[model samples]
Target: MGRVAGKVALVTGAGLGLGRASSLLLASEGARLVVSDIDEGLATHTAAEIVRGGGEALALRHDVSKPEDWSAAMAAIEQRFGRLDVLVNNAGIAIARNIEDTSLAEWRRTMAINLDGVFLGCQEGIKLMKKSGGGSIINLSSIDGVIGEADLAAYCASKGGVRTLTKAVAVHCAEQRYGIRCNSIHPGYIWTPQTENYLRDLGTLEQEKAKALSRHPIGFLGEPNDIAYMVLYLASDESKFVTGSEMVVDGGYLAV
Candidate 1:
């Protein structure tokens, strides 16, 4: 049997990149998937892909920054699956800018999507998880969260917020005996659309890639599946004893 058999998992930003990879992996492991994205077409396509692969999935356009959107999403989950076993807060954006270059709007936008979204997810997740007798929450934080960077000021702040918020939520769930687990995943230099855009303007594609590759001692950039593998473990019963942890899957980027 699959590791997450019979579990119901909701993955935000499931339309693409790490989010899509995590959704696909979880569904393959037997979790009924709730594939959500801000883009309706993307979410629908992801859900269809899962079904074609012999997995059960539902598609919903969700904006994690909005509480109303979250409520509606929870309603859909309750109506379709009756319980929520896992929530992956994988929706986020990174603005490539220094403090001097960042505007108020950019900072607020970053916080809304990165920080506020996770806060809303945790709030709603805990409520539904309480009703379901427990669940797991995986927040997609970056290696930037643990370290400060001059260029990614807003991204850094927002991700750092997620790191702390995850811990606080984990502690609360444990104290309440809610049986829920909350944790953050810190990844470094994963090859995703966002990162592609981040490096595209810096220089030639090959030059930017070489610079990125040199950052990791592992000698290569990581694929989405690397992070997905970690998500699968955390989403499964194998991580029941794990909570309030910052699980790093950075390909040794932070080691040096």
Candidate 2:
């Protein structure tokens, strides 16, 4: 029952979707959770949920794209938890515009949240983890990072950057004997509010939903838990040998 008993983990964007799912699952399995989100209310709600479920949890207002915020978050975690064992760089945004149509602003925003955010989290997380004998770092990439789609240029680029960045960090940690493991997860189509918003922007809700479903041979969309379970494995000691690896939870979407 206690897959990660007594470990402390910080999850960015823990208030929503996959992040929320991962936080809940980790807490359920006996990990103390640092639930972070840009939205203070959502963060509080998530932490409250965990606590109500008789789990250890703390909520923090975190803007992952801001280096200063990362510093403050680390300070808070160190103060409250004394050490950190896991960092899930799960906070990200998607801009469904092709390169030509995507504005500079949009592209920059995507990179800031999706790519820069992960970079900052890793930097600060490594510092905390090293003090505690290292930990696991999971960066959430996407199937688009591996197989490109024309409309997802900016999103794809940021995720692709994350994919490679994870490997580089893994290599450095291993060579330095940091005991920390870094990996990336590439998820295909999981039904989340972000996807709903993206789908709304694409076209008719039902039509686009149907089209999206057709791409995945699994015959259905995924839930946040689909990705969360994998995050748990990576966060746990069971995956000790796993580092610098890309775990795909795309429901066979990448197969076709």
Candidate 3:
């Protein structure tokens, strides 16, 4: 029951979807949580849920793209937890525009939230985790990170960056003997608020759902828990020897 007993985990985008799911699971498994999201109300709700479930959590309003916000969030975590054990870089945005159709501002916005956020999380997380004898950094990439989606050019680019960045962070931590492990998770069409919004923007929700389901090969899309379980494993001592790895949880979408 106590998979990560006494550990401290900070999950970004804890407002909803995969982030919310991961935070709940971590808390259930005995980790104290720092739930940070751009929406303070959402973060507070998540923290309240954890508290109601007999877990410890702290909620904060944070903008991952801002260095100042990162600094402030880290300071708050340090004050409340005294040490950090896990960092989940789960906040991101996806643009459904191909390169040809994508505006400069659109591309920049996508990169700012999806790519820059993870980069900052890694940098700031490493600094704090190093002080606490090192920990795990989980970056949320996507199947698009490994494969390309013509309409998701910017998302694919940012997630691809996350995949490679995770490997680099892992190797650096190992070389520095910091006891930290970093890995990326590539998920395939998980049905979340973000994904739903992305799809609804493109066309009819039912048609988009059918198209997404057909690609999975498993007959259906994945749930947030599917990814949350992986997060649990990575956060636990079970994955001490696992680092710089790309864990694909894609209902075999990449196989076809």
The global Cα lDDT (0 to 1) of model 3 is 0.96
lDDT of 2 by residue, 1-256 (tens): 7999999999999999999999999999999999999998999999999999999999999999999999999999999999999999999998779889999999999999999999999999999999999999999999988878888899999999999999999999999999999999999899999999889889998999999999989999999999999999999999999999999998799998
How well does candidate 3 match the true structure in TM-score terms? 0.99
Please report, in order, the local distance difference test score of every candidate based on alpha carbons: 0.94, 0.95, 0.96
**Could you tell me the TM-score of candidate 2?**
0.99
lDDT score at residue 53, model 2, on the 0-100 scale: 96
Candidate 1 TM-score, C-alpha based: 0.98
lDDT of 2: 0.95
- Least lDDT summed over 10 consecutive residues: which range in candidate 3? 211-220
- lDDT ranking from best candidate downward: 3, 2, 1
**TM-scores of the candidates in the order shown:** 0.98, 0.99, 0.99
> Clashing residue pairs, candidate 2?
none
Please count the clashing residue pairs in each candidate, in the order shown. Answer: 0, 0, 0
Backbone clashes in model 2:
0
Off by over 4 Å in 1: none
